[model samples]
Target: MTQPPAAGPTPPPGAGWSGADEIHDGLPAAPAEPGAGGRGLRRGLLVAGATAGVLVLGGTGYAVATYVSGGGNQPEEVLPADTLAVVKLDLDPAAGQKMAVSSLLDRFPSLTSGEDDDDLRSTLVTPLLADNEWGLTYEQDVEPWLGNRMAVAAVPDPGSEAGVAGVVVLAVTDEAAMTERLEAVPADSFAFAVRDDFVLLGEDQALVDRLAAGGSTLAEDAGYTEDVDALDGDQVAVAWADLAGLQDVVPLAEAGAGLGDQALSGRVVLGVHAEDDALEVTGLTRGTAPTTSTAATEPTGLAADLPADTVAALSVSGLGEALTTSWATLQESGIPPEFEEQIEALGLDLPADLGAVLGTDLAVAVTGDLAAPQFGARVRTDDPQRATEVIDRVAGDAELPVAVSPLDDGYVLASDPALADALAADGGLGDTEAFRAAVADPDDAGAIGFVDLGELIDEVVAQGGDDAAQAQEYAALGALGFSASTTDDGGRFVLRVTTR
Candidate 1:
């Protein structure tokens, strides 16, 4: 449903791709011969080496291949047109992990469950390095080529080392030493050529040359540029994908209806930023939706009405409108007949009842311990009497898991009658400190979610009869929350975790 963008506007000054800025001389460009073990083998080694470097560096690794230097900041300029996906990661994994562990210690000073930096390195990094030969020079060779930014492009290929289309990595780094190291590598083992400061690593020398030539770059893609730049530039990292190109590759027969038309064909961008003592991961994506679906404003005091002990809560608005809109489109597209037929086969009338059963705004919350979970829902409908009839009818026929009860201007659906009654109580979640601390900007959130990880872990521990290890792992989590809102181009979802 998302129409691809036309040609992108001119890139702002200094906003060009990194690592490919300057032209340089190195090994003569050669045509990559098919079935030669050299290209494929070297590519495989490069990938493994890069992955090892990231882990060894403790998450400071760039997403794709690189020992960067000698280029502008726009690494994406090197990506070919057939690129199926591009990913970028810029987090200092070590710092992030340290922050998370320290926060966990602050929350549960007595809980001795999580691993320290050294322990993590020994347990995770060392073993992975030991298993791969490329790990030998990961520190000296691979790590030096990377800077704070890196981008990887996945392209289709039949002769790649992985027996699929090969990938390319771009990063900004000083390449003198990197180039020397590559020259020393056995020519029969690997193939690579340095172009100025940019190091292109892939299975095919010809493809790599084409990449260095800078024809039809991903940077030239207007839609991708718009989506990636839309994210906060200060993010620890950023990433984007070419869903439309991918849709073209996979066979139509293999792609089910869910993965077929209306399922995909657009771009997605993701970013991560650390702020307010919370690490936020944000994403913007437009695959099937034609336009941003606006959310109705949730009632101000909805959370305040919940039980004080409620450990988790979520509030979503505009569902009724979304469903109705989707249903209409489905009808126009000839999908409703099949859907209706399926519903009828199951002795149900979905088209006649779905809209009447659900409300425009919905709030669901969880209370009690993990051993005895309690759930509650509040649905705001235009006609409560009709909603009650529909709900009661479903309950009578055991079509639903729980009965729905009428409440003030809405309906309460819960796991138990007592839980429903508790929801109807006068108090709400907004008055609670935990809820306030978890949500970042509740007033503007189209959809909001909160989790008291400490409390949830307590429930997990209570229910852990013999799985002490699993219980301990849960203890490392403190509290987390998320907020969703509509953006001009697409939707933005942000997740935050206040580590314990």
Candidate 2:
């Protein structure tokens, strides 16, 4: 198992954690009006007036609480830390989602070493939980307990701003009436929910990619349609909404740092709306927690200075053209709308020629040459319809003939084979000093990227081989474009070569 990186190089206490869960203030909105019942409306009016008075006259009104939950329970397919390695996501949610599934599908085991209880809570968890509008903010941090099964539920305050990890939400319209809603949930049902997922960026990039494509799937989606008993090693956790509800959080037996060590604390905001559904949940922060286990002091080579710009840069950073060429591989998969949004949200830049290839919703813009790959996905949608529209727009207007087709649950539209053949037949890869020179210049530093020799070798091997290993290798290639072909027995391999 790979060991955690040294603490000496860790990001400053506030580095990656600062914006982990940031909910921008001032989204557009207007004051809610009273409800339908004359008596009830009068009561709500009085409360709103009173709350407003406390704010204007008293000048010490507490913040309104806010929380968000995924509409109902969304099914989850996961590989917790126990079964495999933890996967750190790009601060971008969609990108993180793709990275999660990709890491699992690729087969990288969630190694024992990952963001440990303390590190996760402080760096990755605290900000997410505190930033939410739940009105209860704690600095305690929380992380996924590698070996256990867990679930998470969050009850948000009706009128506050906050951030969250992975949650769906609805607006609440009633404030005072919420007492009934809170009372209805079984006291036991509000125990605790574990938010568990894995990080696949392993010490070895190849190992990480292999796992993303074919890792062991530990937790299957529970469907959440009916009450299901907890699986072995599973824990039932409760979610919290307003300050009144959260007040009891610490009092719960299973509350501190958490049983599995995946807990972090942050601030929560609240809102008291006239209607029960008008309340909005804004952020989620993990709890800052202490642990008993002695952390592994061994260090990995990964740098700890993950600034937003740097992190965003790493989102595109790689060793060679594989990233630049990722369009081909991405083309091979279905366009998951949510994944696309991640790319756009990362705010990566796009090259005109390549941008034309990926469409707008999601495009892997390659920056380095054949060696060092510095690439980023231009993610743009959570709606598949939007993703398809983007594909249509880009492929439809391409200067070259674009062929659109589905593969492995996703879709890819690429330059016509005939056009590619025309280029190949004309010797695009041979005697083309300009292309080779440009591809070899990633190390110029003065240029867009500095290439790495290792990536070049990987690309060559992938271009010649068609085995599972080669397919896996192609994923790590800086260029994210290509098709991995394997023999029936999965022995023979041929990676149809292409570039973004």
Candidate 3:
């Protein structure tokens, strides 16, 4: 880390620095800018915040460490059940930094600019190094003591940044030393309180106090726990969010073109883990909105017809059902009146002929060399003859010249009729070595897709002007694949990308 600038003369020992200057009734005013050291420290904090945000995009704390050690309270107990979102980790900051940097290097070599860990550490990490005793205590004692059970949470708050308060909780050791260190540091920005086994820190002192007092606990939140339980815990980090509640606090949710239009009233949980040479970030989003019942997808076995060389494919069961439910949601959201008007303009009865329009089963794929791309769409229907008639009618009404031809179990639709014919002629991706290597146990999945990175990069270079595709990182990536499965209660989706 970067060495902080000089902090000037040291305060006289035992001054308690806890004088009136340090105490605030509520929301302490921003402190005067310190010298160069303080400025560097602030910059470092900003960078660290940015880094933390990046880490969250992919995916802990000491009730957390004890939990990891299998001898203490569960990490979830650190936050009350009312938490809007929480991210828990079992790894220390230093170790996490190492793992993140390593994975990033493997995933994108160009990011390092030819610098090794030591060189990068000196240049990038050095600036954030603090020289105070508080910094020393946190790095050497507090962090190590907390072990793996450190966590951060977003909770409901009327007075806070973005109208939602955030708290960082961690188990403590050497309480006296920790208190002394904390008191010695400048307290203009954050307020912290110590509990029996842990410490709570946040921008709002009252919020931190409430959490420390176990008020409006998130541990008791049924929705939050359900989502958290769904997440894979063996990873480096896991995060849970109450999407509906967050919509009220986060500006992005209230703005147009956001989750509001999608009617995403549910929770999202994600687990982030680092593999041998790749990083995996998987999330599960469950909608709580009352949805119109739609028919379940019936197996069509269309996956068997995709070409062996197919790189990317999207398979859907009961496409008509999914579309119907989605269309209902759009109508209820009251944001897109044009869609209903357009449907009327097309003179199409979606519910009456959705089976023919979208097919019972749908599969789309991008195949062949990236330099020369091929696209194909295949769908299953109960009646192929009737489906053909509806397709022709829609084409004539919309002035779209679409051609649907018979495939194994249904019909194939494509811009070029020859492409549709080509899809029906080949042995499918299920039999290909690339598909087997890229996805795990594809035979049982409800939906699946794959993308060949090498081909994608080549196409990018060919199509993009300038240096868009001139990165070595593209060479490191092999393929990306995603799969989904429906259960009795809900569904699960996973997307995985591997290294070459």
Candidate 4:
């Protein structure tokens, strides 16, 4: 396990109790008093928020070391169905996931350097217990009961105008020990209840009590279930948000103007999964605005036809039409006046002429030696002559460092005339082993991107410095690829980093 910096030494048994008692004794006499609601609730919420943050950090590290597969007790199973947001960490995962994380740690031993043992008590519980105002100690209070999974959730608070409350759910091995610790904490606002094998901590006693009773749960919500099920692999960590539910706490106007009506009506789910040679993050959004018919579709292998030596490349199709269709929306969304002036200065109409310049399919690539790399762009067009005229108009008076050449059905623009000629010829970037390994389904993606990490690292190494030394450590790390596509409900995105 990764051993982070020590938080500090643990206090002797009961040594910090005097200070905690003093602090608690200083509180307002009545729970309903004005000062109690203000100061006491704020203090309790701070502790709860800090505890949740620390546990998330600790849980993520623990999951990386001890994850396994199979259904287990999840926080959603107990949280209210109206939860606005939740972050969960699972320490136990499946056998395959364990091996994947273990292999990754092996490849990068620095990730766990300075660790004494793999025990969660040493890495997680110890830091939290040390020198806390609550007078808790790891060996005496927490270590005897800590369990493997934890989650922090934000739920609506019906009684408050803020409309939200924070809850920390911790799975415990011994309910008795967990209850003893909660009873000993010296804070008026602190409230806790043990439900089954988990402890629920919050600032609001009424809210905590209600949750302990457990009517409907987040796991039972149809939208939550569907989004969680949509994740691609066994997740080590997950985060979810109910956008519509959160509007009661924070207004949509605060997010920014021009958001569609249905934008906040949806939910967002993000998950992290470990793979044999990489760690993958997948994201899915549901009930957002639908993709317009003019939106880009699958690539037509434009980037794949770039030179095999390409260091980086990107390709997308139908962007011109999309730009044209969304122009009015963009204007309303606050496109700067200077930007429009710049477009007009290029001797082009606002959207139509600019759309003609972009054409139907567009691709950009970087190739040649790193020191003097070549840059090129290709735009597919049915009217090659008109596109050439637009390109010339945009590059007027040699203002831009580019030369344009006509292809059979498109135009190629490059920093060097030779590169423009080369981009017009047959190429084989798709056939390269690195390209194939990085991108999974380039042809089917609406947008595709690739980066030659190895080549970039080589350049850094050549530049020799502390950065070069650090770059050498990632020698085994190879290319990175990204792909995105519109789904029926929303969109799907995947990012992968390949390692040798």
Tell me the whole-model lDDT of each prediction, alpha carbons only.
0.56, 0.26, 0.56, 0.69
In TM-score terms, candidate 1 sits at: 0.64
Q: Looking at model 2, which ten-residue stretch has the lowest summed lDDT?
A: 59-68
The residue-by-residue lDDT of candidate 4 on 142-253, one tens digit each, is 6667777789899989797777889998887776545545565654747877666677888877788788787999989998989988998788778989877787576766
Of the pair 2 and 3, which is ahead by lDDT?
3
Query: What C-alpha lDDT does candidate 1 achieve relative to the native structure?
Result: 0.56
Best by lDDT: 4
Q: Model 1 off-target regions past 4 Å?
A: 1-74, 77-84, 91-149, 155-166, 170-191, 214-226, 242-260, 263-266, 286-305, 320-348, 399-403, 458-476
| Highest-scoring model, TM-score | 4
Number of colliding residue pairs in each model: 24, 166, 30, 6
Residues 1-500 of candidate 1: C-alpha lDDT, one tens digit per residue: 11112123523223221232222222222334656443233234223322322222223222211122222455566666556777754433335434542443343333333433222222322333343333233344444455444556777664444423555464536555455445444445444554444566765666666566666877787877777777764555667776666656654335564533454556777876544334556777765433243455442335556777888788777676667667766766686568566566545555445665566777788887645677888877776777777777667665666757886677888988888888777656776766666566677667777777656556545655543333454354445677776655556677766544
Per-residue lDDT tens digits of candidate 2, residues 1-500? Answer: 22222213323333233332342332222224744443233233223322322221111101101111122221123332122111111111222222322232232122112433122223323444443443223231222112121223232222334321222211122221222222223333222121223322222323333333433343342212111121111111212222223333332235442333333232221111111111111111112222121111111111111111111111122212323455565555566879677556643333333333332223222233333323333222223343445555654554435544432222333344332222222122212322222222222211121122224434445545332242332232221111111112111111111121
Candidate 2, which segments miss by more than 4 Å at Cα?
Answer: 1-118, 121-124, 132-138, 141-422, 426-500
TM-score for each candidate, following the candidate numbering? 0.64, 0.19, 0.62, 0.78
Clashing pairs in 4: 67-93, 68-92, 68-93, 68-94, 69-93, 69-94
